[model samples]
Target chain A: MTLKLKLHTKPEVPLEADCICPDRMQSLNMTEIGDLVTYHGNRQVPLKNFFECSGEFDGEIDIEGDLVNVKHIGSTMSFGKITVSGNVGVHIGAAMSGGEIIVEGDASDWVGPEMYGGRITIKGNAGHMVGSGYRGSTVGMQGGEIIVHGNVKNETGHVMRRGLIVVAGNSGDFTGVNMLAGTIIVLGEMGIRTGAGMRRGSIICQTKSELLPTFTRSCDYLPLFLRHYFKHLESLGLIISDSLINSPFERWCGDSIELNRGEILLYAGK
Target chain B: MKIKSTTIVDTFAEAFNMYVSRVIITADSKEWAIAAAQSITGFATSVIGCKCEAGIETIIDPNDSPDLRPGVSVLIFAMDAESLGKRLIERIGQCVMTCPTTACYNGLAGGSPVIVGGKLRYFGDGHQISKVIDGLKLWRIPVMDGEFLVDDRFNIQEAVGGGNLLILGKDQKVTLKAASAATKAMGKLTDIILPFPNGVVRSGSKVGSKYKKMIASTNDAYCPTLRGVVEKSELDDGINSVLEIVVDGLTLKAVENAMRVGLMAAIKPGIKKISAGNYGGGLGQHHIHLLKLGF
Candidate 1:
């Protein structure tokens, strides 16, 4: 019996419903789950005030509605799965350690910020900071994967220390900025200042992009490790061209102002 | 049991418990993959002298390989897990890593983890980089061609080794022909390998020797040249030449299957008898009886 939550009344303001997570609702009854506290804007309110909750929790939660005002849904969740039917607000799956979240529609800013482990897949476009750390945090997305099928706004994977972030569409500026370690692959065009202050990590781009001066062009070679990643992404329903997998990439070692150990691989087509 | 002119001797093959590791070596082309595979499996015929027994299991298709490249699967067997791990690092680093356009990966999904690429990464001298995909770590060491990518750890599991089948024929020509046919049939199976030169061994040995320093000597009972001198000769009147096929596999069932398949394929007109080598069932853990193979 999956836990079902359908938004019956659109909140006038953003609702903080972190209690919708599987870890918190797995042991609660329907009435107890409905009575869970959720903050409507700055005021406290029961979850039953805005959303109708039914079904028993069985390691899976299916949420239906526009949920554009729902924030922190599945935050810090360590297990189970959450499937969203419509657009979701900010901070979905933030700091989640395990399980999975699949958003069928567009997502707001800060998707899976500082996530320790788990997977977050967005079917549509995403707002700014797809997998970035919070303010003053040194690391973002320590582990896990964030796959966005559509375009994403700026500061993707900011200060990311570990994990994989794959954007199938275009990406905004400062992609993988200040990244200490991790892998961020953008299959489409990337905006300026990629890997700006990254100390050690890999940022792969399928198309040509103007890079910052801190990065240095190393050599042109086929990276064998990317084939494994491409195969993994292909298994996730992404169409990876044969040419892209077989082509050589221009290896650029960058962030000379920092450790100068990070690398950016830009595709050099056959 | 008689299959045409060949008689299946009522004996068992003694196989010992050993540790095995499967390595997947992929390269730019099938030729280079086979080249690396051949190089790594060299000088590894038997554990008695080589410290390990290894053979190429199969050639993997590009689509089925770990990196979507042409690959060759090779299996190595050692007396223990620690020695198997050490042999993996030594052989992969020296042979596969040194080969052109080759990358090595652990073929087994689960076993006792042994660090191979983790120790081989030092050859890069601080230039090596590590990548983790799907929870499996791989090390990429900078090479003159491009990079040598290898798995961080290879898994070793308990296996069966030293399974043998002895073929007696009218002459050396017919004996070699039957042994070749048997190896060709057994080669199609998975999880097993014939670990001898062209899958046949002529110098079968006994447990002891006349010399004090030697641990093993020739099996005089099966030697046709010594049949008249030795009172306990296993050869018949017409049997003039004999050959042995050694099988090492990841499982006892795999060894039995290969032996069964080889026994069926080796039944020819010139073949006299098909028997198995054993030490009166005193050594080894698994005893594969020829009559109980469900022929």
Candidate 2:
């Protein structure tokens, strides 16, 4: 069962989905007319004010049409699958532990911030802080996997302790600023100051670009461990093709000033 | 009752309780997923010799997998949770981490299996990174191959093991063939999964050994020569061969379904009556009544 919520032509005003019920998502059976939360104006409003609610109690929900003002599609949703057919606002799946979020279109900032588990896939592009630490803290994301198909802004994986963040398009400055742990793989060119203060993690930049002066080059040898990792990246639809997954990587271990356990590994063509 | 001209046994197939967990490994392609599974499940034939029994449960499509890649689900069973955890770490470290484009995940969502990934993360040597998406915690251990992704925790469940029905045939070939056919049919089951090499075992052991050092030994009652003098003999003349199939299931009802289908498949051409090896009713609480099932 699925709940289809269509937010058509809503301008300004952020329609936060903090009150949207996820437990009843799958129970909705989805066959009947489901509930939706659309907004108009520049003020804050509850979710129940917009769309009419109706449906069975199945564990699934879908958001159709344009949702430029809709924020937090599946915030803190533990179970159930959520699909968005069009573009969305900020905080797509903040703190989501279980369930899946599929966005056929692009998304705004913080795609999957602090998610413990679950998955979020964006077909188009994503904005800044896609999977970064909230407000003042580091330790950005603890768990979960985020796959962004388009370009992203800077500070992508700032202090993420765990989880996987894959960006298919180019990235902005500070690719993985102050990253404590986790993996951030950028398929396209990376902006300046990549992996600046990374302590214990990996940042794989597929494109050949300049790195922050702080990052130190360890060696040119291919890491034996990456053969298995690259292949996994392909399966997730996050990285290079499977046939060329096992290519050699240019290994650089830096952000040496910090915990120094982190590494920025780029695929070095053999 | 007869199936393919073979007599149906009047006895039930007995089973014992064991710990089970499912492991899902995903990689760049179906080939790498299968490769990792084969490596991890290799040399793990049984609890008696290998300390555990494991096999590939099913292949997952990209859409269904966590990473949307080619992946395979494997079921691993052992005598207890400790062993299960140890084997998982050992196998994933050596096999999955070595296989190109492979990432390991806990197939079991909730329950018991001691956390497999949270423990193995130390192997990352401080390079290990964890991710919490949707509530599931995953570990990313940076390996030379790139990175090995795995689920943080694996649910452990109590499962029935050693559920078997011996195939008594005129020759070894016929015995193996009949047993293979039965196992092949049962292997496709969802409730019970066969964790063995090709789903058949030639050596079926018994409880307690004649020697003082051994805890359990071979079944002498089924031995053709010992058939007469054996106190609880279940074999007769012309019964030259015997083979056992072990099934692991989440529920007793699941085991029963497997046995019903297995027994029916076992008794085929060149086969005799089917019988289960049990240490009496005292050993197990869940029992399958052969008569009730057949009727």
Per-residue accuracy of model 2 over B1-295 as CA lDDT, tens digit each: 5666676666766677888888888888899899999999998877877898888777899878766678888888888888888888888888888898888877776667577789889988866766554446677776665667777888888887777777888778888888888887887787567777787876677878879987778788777667778797777677888788777776777777887788887776778767777777778655666666743
Candidate 1 all-Cα RMSD: 1.4
Worst 10 residues of 2 chain A by lDDT: A30-39
Q: Model 1, residue B58: displacement in angstroms? A: 0.9
DockQ values of all predictions: 0.78, 0.16
lDDT of residue B220 for candidate 1: 95
| lDDT tens digits by residue: candidate 1, A1-270 | 899999999999999999989899988899999999999999999999988988889999999999989999999999999999999999999999999999999999999999989999999989999889998999898999999999999999999998999999999999999999889999999999999999998999999888999899999999999999999999899999999999999999979999998999999995
Model 1: CA > 4 A from native: none
Q: Which lDDT value does model 2 have at A267?
A: 69
lDDT of 1 by residue, B23-140 (tens): 9999999999999999999889889889999999999999999999999999999999999999999999999999999999999987889999999999999878888887888999
RMSD of each: 1.4, 7.2
Candidate 2 residues A90-134, lDDT tens each?
998888888888889989988888888788888898988877879
lDDT value, residue B95 of candidate 1? 95
